[model samples]
Target: MVTSVAPRVESLSSSGIQSIPKEYVRTQEELTSITNIFEEEKKAEGPQVPTIDLKDIDSEDKLVREKSREELKEAAVEWGVMHLVNHGIDDDLLERVKKAGEAFFNLPLEEKEKYANDQESGKIAGYGSKLANNASGQLEWEDYFFHLIFPEDKRDMSIWPKSPSDYIKATSEYAKLLRGLATKILSILSLGLGLDEGRLEKEVGGMEELLLQMKINYYPKCPQPELALGVEAHTDVSALTFILHNMVPGLQLFYQGKWVTAKCVPNSIIMHVGDTIEILSNGKYKSILHRGLVNKEKVRISWAVFCEPPKEKIILKPLPEVVSEAEPAIFPPRTFAQHIQHKLFRKTQDALVSK
Candidate 1:
């Protein structure tokens, strides 16, 4: 329920401010934790997020395909996030998608405001900046443009940028490709769980009913980079999130009591297993907590596509295949909308307690 009308970080960075606003500053403890991340990473021996090559995913050799699937499954269980190389999306298409997002973010503030979101009114799509609904009310040092791109009929083209003539066209093509990739990942994950290849996908939502939402995150350079985060730590609610980021590094994931910065590979897409998948898999798969950090140099941009279930569809419990007398359902039945409401309510209560 936090509605943001704050100034974009891009504008703030260029405003000649020596430091970020107090509201954007983190507490001393939070600062200390992140400041020593490098030292912690050095001492820690944890499973690093794996980079899996998907070029041979459809290989004629059955052993090669099986090995690829097992690697993906292990990454899902251990880290819940992984980078995919040669994911079949064309290099030209990838560049076009990045350029489209960059073009939109490069527009003047007023022009960008034409598509601003009204989160207060429950409209989440379009351009906006979110102020975290936490105890300190810290403002995330990022601006984003969000909208659903799949199931073409669900699109609201009015909010889509018009200034960049090819934005819609390029993004639409990218979405279709990502959707296929998502389906393939789900199939492999399902097989890994000893279920039919399509079991997990069907449990969440079939291809036609699934929701694919796109969010373009632009983390601008910050004056006080140590004190402010580009994004707050949290887990994604979607089933899967496929990301394409400009090679500048900032993404960090919590793993085995350490924060590990994900090393970016050019022309690669990173994928995350989200809460929905974790719930459906009966906690067998993880939904790791992650956040974005900002730096004094260079803007970091990422394009994330979330594969989700329709709001009204009920995730009635963990998949039958994953549950047994030994391992019962760990999560309660809830519609996607109810799950969102519960999370929002929890945030509100946490804020109140901290205050």
Candidate 2:
């Protein structure tokens, strides 16, 4: 099991090197002193992505299903993101998950560290502050915990939170619901690509190896919100990501050559394509760049569930049906593991350069 480290405050000037704790409530002075290298000059007007009601797709009428498919396809190609409504997940379950996240994050730094990320072993399924290496001493102004929920054998219970009493139960139920939804979404996307609904799922090893990972992000209020970023600009590495964020507006997506703010709709979940999906669709779909902004007064919490193929080695490439003489494959065939590793390395390099 990975050991947790307590947050320690050292008396250092703004210009001097300082070590920020993995999870701690930041003081007003400390929040103001942190440099924001990701400040933006202007924000976009509104959400560029469209919203789709899943109920439309579930309708008994064939015409309704077709229309919903068309709308989803368009959103996938144009924005690579969308909001999902009537997704069938219980509101109470969502509330439970949120409460559990809050409980865990509210724990003392030392307690939280008990499940620190095992970086030495390249395991990220635990509490951590940054995903990429901070060789240049620059980091995002957020704390997060990552864990795998599917493929039960692959889960490390040691890293799972024991406190919050119902944290495990709540997360487990949430994961079950998310898995079913993801499978349905993937089936719809396959139909949108002019293939059998189950084709894409089968190619990725179906339910057996289906990888479902969850990330809970906590962004504390920053005194100088304009000068700091909760998370840097980047695209997800999974096939698809479903996110539930509170009303605090901070999520932004890069669209039409500008950064547009993603507005939160009550009880709605945001869904977005990831790099793997882009590759599977042969450039027909997109994986957009997004980031989290900080606020001066409100703390933000978000739960993101990432869906991908099973762990067994599988080559990821655009389906043949989606590619032809008119549209050739744009990406080379690569194993899923290889693709993820390459993306992580590139992100680390980019982060280092930015610092």
Candidate 3:
């Protein structure tokens, strides 16, 4: 005989609002019961993601720069991810950004609601606590806020936090620094592919249309961590993503058909190739599949900046330099919007059937 399990419900009390239902707080017992089902057996240790120094890439020595470029190519082709050090962002600035995020999240729930995401309107540039309404069993164990930074005109202040007055300033400064780093990295990647340094940048539409978006993710400590996933497995949908992970070990990526944890390194940033790059390279490079694991003890926080083509509708195709008669295009041309919409649809479908 089959048995039916009752769904769990949670409540949230905002400042003015009396009660909010279906917030999805799991109990320890419930969490433990599902742990065994999703747990994976530990695999033997293997190579970790490659680490590269930005200083070396900027060296005046031609041989030194070429060597760094080769290393980048190897990392991009083999792991689709790498750890970046000495990227030139101020350490104090990084700390300030993290502190700003923490302060906003710590605000009274009512205050945070002012920036709540409007799913019906298809705007994701605000705060979001729950993944889906009334979908108790299908929720992800995290809270996030997203916003666009570049092209200043595209910024939607309605969703930006006003309580922490410096939040905007801090994030903006950090993004500026990241933008510089991203441009350099893109040029290095082009060289690695045997193309003119400016070729890839030109194809994606120079700095004028370059898009940079920020996502602040907070993963609260879970009572039964093993049973819940902080984030489900998926590949990013942008050209590249730079992650400022707090001192936590919850990030993991699939490499060589095995899951490997991404350990945090001090004073460094983690870079992951996204779907756009894979298409642009004609599959010469890969978009890494990764996920977040929850911890029963520590709450993890991370800041991710996704760099991609502008919001304008432009079809992304494999560049001619990377595709030829000898090596045809592996991925067909598609607009960035189309690619993201499809990914979201698939994620929604998966959530609906998750339990």
Candidate 3 global Cα RMSD: 6.3
**Best model number under TM-score:** 1
Pick out the ten consecutive residues of candidate 2 with the lowest summed lDDT: 6-15
> Per-residue lDDT of 132-215 in model 1, one digit per residue for the tens?
655557788899999999978888888889978889999999988898998999999898889998988887788788899999
What are the runs in model 2 whose C-alpha is more than 4 Å off? 1-47, 131-137, 348-355
**Residue lDDT tens for model 2, 117-228:** 8655777778876633534444577888899987677777778899999998998898889888888888988888888999877776688877889999888766555555
Using lDDT, rank the candidates from best to worst: 1, 2, 3
C-alpha RMSD by candidate, in order: 2.5, 5.5, 6.3
Better model by TM-score: candidate 1 vs candidate 2: 1
Model 2 lDDT, residue 294, Cα: 76
Which residue pairs of candidate 1 clash? none
lDDT for each residue of candidate 3 in 1-355, tens digit (9 for 90 to 100): 4422122111111122222223333434445333321233233357677887777887899899888788888898888899888889988898888889988988876687688776556766888754453333446677888899775776776677876888989888898889888888888888878889887777666777778889888887665566666776689988889999777777778787767777677888999988988889998888999878776557688998988886456788898888889999987777888887777777667556664
By lDDT, the best candidate is 1
